[model samples]
Target: MNIYRHEMRMSLRSMLYWTTGMLVGLLFFMMMFAAVSEEASVINLIVSQFPSEVVRALGLSTLDLSTVLGYYGYVFMFILLVASVYALKIGISALSEEIRAKTADFLLSKPVSRNVIVTAKALSVITLLALQSAIYSLGAFIIVDIITGQPYDKTVFLLINLSIFLVGLFFAGLGLLLSVSIKKIKSVLPVALGIVFGFAILQMLNQSLADPVLAYLTPFAYFDIARIINARAYESAYVISDAVLIVSFTLLTYIIYRRKDIPSV
Candidate 1:
């Protein structure tokens, strides 16, 4: 409990600015939804003018755009991108900064165990992501509900939130692994960002190549937003793959971190 509080305090202090910025950015996108929902002609014009590929890429689809959920989902595609980036950023410093700042030595000098430290940090990251996601979803829901006056699928909405949350956990584990393996914290953020963007590009390429087999190689391909909308259920393969990645990375990171020579603070 003490470790959790300590780690949560550290994470919140570091990430509060980014979380606030994400919420503000999400608000702007929600406002755009409000504007577009005011006119049926505008929605028709958009659907007519936009290419099907473009619409799918942007997470806009053959759904009724005037409805609050559809509009919120449309705008949320971009917000998701930002939120994912923020997740990577949070993870970059999760363990890497402790090593780089030479604080790991001081912390370890205490009675805290390595697993406790790792678990506490993991909890902190998950807690931060949940808080940010909840705030963003709540704010958008209120804005959209007021504009459309209709209740949508709360189950599906929560599913979307959970999917993103799981993805964040995957990235956090990846970041922790990198932090343990690499000697420098400065390299953590760029490497994490590169890996994420690289996965996205692979998903795009797999689509271009027209290969279903390739979809298994990347998370983005399996976790398609359009499919998510149509099915209203996250792909089980992705949920399983993410679970594997999280577990694999967590174990690997713990092993490496335990062996690391901690420098003085």
Candidate 2:
């Protein structure tokens, strides 16, 4: 419990800042929805002139910019990207912070077991993730309502925003595993940024190639924003894949962290 409390306290400010930035950015983008929607046909036509693969890669093909949800879903991809980076940064930083700061020895001096410590760290990250998702989603819905003054499917809007939570979990899990697996992490932001963008690049390939195999490589591809708009629900296979990968990463983190030697300052 002490460990959990400590982790949460350490993470709270960073989480709030990131969530606020994302919300503000989303608001800025959604504010343009009215103007964009009015010119949707011309924009869509210009988008169509590009190669089909390029169009699909940009997600300009399926998502119509004419509707409220369509525009939200389209621009929301940037939100997801930022959210993923934030999640990964915290995940990598959470466990690694103690070590990087040369405080692991002091932490291990406590009576609590390593397993308990790992559980606390992981749960703290998860809790912050849930709060971040909730805060931003609520703000998002309210913003859209106020700006558009137009009715959109609440359920689908939610499903679209829910991608942030899912992607956060996946990256958090990966961060924990990497924290335990790597011998040294000089800086987490660069590592997190690189990895997230690498996967995002893979998502571009997945979109362009339309490959199921490539899609599995990137969590960004898991929740198809456009598909969520159309289907009004998440895709089962990708959801399952996300669950499996998160669980696997978490389990591997536990196992590796348990027996690993802790270097003292």
Q: What TM-score do all the candidates reach, one by one?
A: 0.82, 0.98
Best by TM-score: 2
The superposed Cα distance between candidate 1 and the true structure at residue 227, in angstroms, equals: 2.6
Compared with the true structure, what per-residue lDDT tens digits does model 1 show for residues 96-133? 77777777777788998888788788778889888876
In order, candidate lDDTs are 0.70, 0.92
TM-score of candidate 1 relative to the true fold: 0.82
- Candidate 2 is scored at a TM of 0.98
Clashing residue pairs in candidate 1 (N, C-alpha, C atoms within 3 angstroms): none
Q: Candidate 2: which stretches are off by over 4 Å? A: none
lDDT of 2: 0.92
